[model samples]
Target: MSSYYGLPVLKEPVWKVPDVPAYLYLGGMAGASSTMALLADLTGRRHLARAGRVAAAVGATASVGALVHDLGRPARFLHMLRVFKPTSPLSVGSWILAPFSGLAGAAAASELTGLLPVPGKAAGVLAGFLAPAMTTYTAVLLADTAVPGWHEAYRELPFVFAGSAVASAGAVGLVAAPAQARPARRMAVAGSALELAASRRMEARLGLAAEAYRTGRAGAVLRVARATTAVGAGLALAAGRSRAAGVAAGACLTLGAVATRYGVFEAGRETARDPRYVVEPQRERVGAPGSEVRGEVHRSSSDGDLQ
Candidate 1:
């Protein structure tokens, strides 16, 4: 083994890079607005729908800033749209995010006399059209990653994230109106269930890639995150079972869900930065059942301390 300052050098790359902050901001905005808008419109709460629209707009705009900031050079941001690159997942999402943000904004704005000259039915129709896809695209953005944990758990990662996004925004809705607490609970419950189902599968199905969920600072955070989201989300189902439980569930569950997202983000970055995360296990996957994993369970240089 080679050594970089007495630390054994592994064969692959460790992606300790933080997630694109823009994606973080935009993902929440897009998710919350989409769910709240759909629910509000269905419940005949035009006001909530409008609020959802505004949040989405603000969220989208903020996201663009985050995206631009993530780049080394902000001026060249337009280059993202200059080409139609299916090979690029971010490219696909940018296109989708741009238009969906517009529709959600317009739809939400229609209820405001100041934003629209004539508040009419077309806005509702357009918003309805954009809502579903808006809910789904964030998952695709994440799954598109080449990172082992992310790309390998492709089938369920999107839904797991989509559920988390809705839960966060729905928490906002719960805080906004007493009337919404019931439905908000439902959203949390469903999203939590889906998130856990996907997550468990991610951990169980991907032997090595999913190692991000089980070890290190990021992994430790992820375990707590899962517990929080699970307990919180499960309590949501019983919100009708008790008011105090409902309030506690809503607040805790929402926090837990958000924590899960952040934890995964942290873990992925850790996995990327460590060559052991990238190589050793992958090699093991190809060898026979009992083959030794080439590089995993990092034995840090300073008596096993990781960064």
Candidate 2:
């Protein structure tokens, strides 16, 4: 591992632990819950639909709060909303979040207050239409960074996030409306399967970057995430009208989702902390073998000449 006196090649991400992870988790949950709400409404599962709407609203609101807290002020979040750059993931995410939040709140309010039912349903449908992008755009946002673990896994990260989102939303449904949770159970199973498969495939394809996910704190959390998600899925399959089993599965799934986000964040930080992750990839890109590159230290003289 060649480096300048063992210093990292890339700066660590400025994102904080709990806040950023919470934002990611809540945004995903909100987006997918909106979709679940729409689906439940269409299928005449009124209770499940109402539950989904409330979850979406609360999640979106909380996600925004988390983001603002991380930014250190409310103005910074509002500053982000001033620009609408289509090419920037952050900008697009802000736009998506802004409208989605409003729509979700409106829908939830209407469902709860029994006012303006028609417009509320319309808002729910619109929010549902945007839900897929809302759920997965954070993956794009993370992948857009130079962090090796996130950038290298870009191909599969969106799928992983989407699956996680679906699973989390379904878990909420199971916990909130157990009696009408048939669709939720199926969603939980399917989403967990997808999340596991995508995550495995992402790790396998990450090559050298995969180490970030298999070693240190990141590895420990991800292992727990996988185990819990798998167990949750299995429990969901057998739950079948058992409220206790469903609630237990939901708890496991929620924990798994939270762990996965934190694990990914930690992995990216780990990759950034290691110069090898940055140097080796550059070497490969430039047709140089990893071992051929050597680190050299240079000092500047008083006259600004390198020595």
Candidate 3:
């Protein structure tokens, strides 16, 4: 087979992966719902809070659905919870997702029938509980993989993923429930800021691997991510007055964040295929005994056998 730019072609998994991306979207939607739910309830907007709870539940359910469908054996999805391993991000994610799903489900049901006491209050508490994990654990999920860019950028990726999740959740709220757009706008700003800051920090620490962000197709993606995040965050400053602007910024941030994830993923794969990253680090690590200077060695994300 002819090579694409002479790069070694690694076969991606053969199983027909569903639109795995929807999982990411659902995650963001659930996370945003939690924030909005709590804010609305706290501010005496019971109707708004009810709406957020329903949305959170629906979004969380959808996220889980997408994740399951993406697996080669969708039925085995339940096995995610059968055991526990801290080193495995998926196992941890399953735990994080479990409470959220139960809570969101309860909250959503309460909204539909108002059949129970303290529907608004219970939902608010659940939303508050799900908010942080919804934002953060996604990073862990991807980071725990043997994937290239993901495993390497462990520290900042969680924050980046969290930031993206928060931003997207706000975007969904803007689309599905506009009345709570103010809190949504505020969250978009915070999430974008955190996302940008974390990405920048990763770019700084990853060094040559950081080139993944600054080069070729991946570079273009990173640029868009940075630009949208910056613009969206700036737009949020005065968004309280203009719902339309908030909506637009939220959408941009959401799309941009997704793009960043894909770009980083592809870039990491590219890094992995090359011999340079694989060879150099080991060379430094395999330095001669008793040399004048120490040459500490480390593995590159590519073929460092660490994946």
Q: Rate the local accuracy (lDDT) of all candidates.
A: 0.64, 0.93, 0.70
lDDT of 3 by residue, 112-224 (tens): 77678586457558667767878677767766655445667888988887777777666655555566567666777777888889889988887566776788888897898
What TM-score would you give candidate 1 relative to the actual structure? Answer: 0.76
Tens-place lDDT digits, model 2, residues 199-262: 9999999989999999999999999999999999989989888999999999999999999999
Model 3 residue 62 lDDT? Answer: 86
Residue pairs with backbone overlap in model 2:
none
Per-residue lDDT of 35 in model 2: 95
List per-candidate RMSD values in Å.
Answer: 8.2, 5.0, 6.2
Candidate with the greatest lDDT versus the true structure: 2
For 17-80, candidate 1 gives per-residue lDDT tens digits of 3335346635664656666766777788755566666666666666666666667566667777
Query: Which wins on lDDT, candidate 1 or candidate 2?
Result: 2
Candidate 3 weakest ten by summed lDDT: 292-301
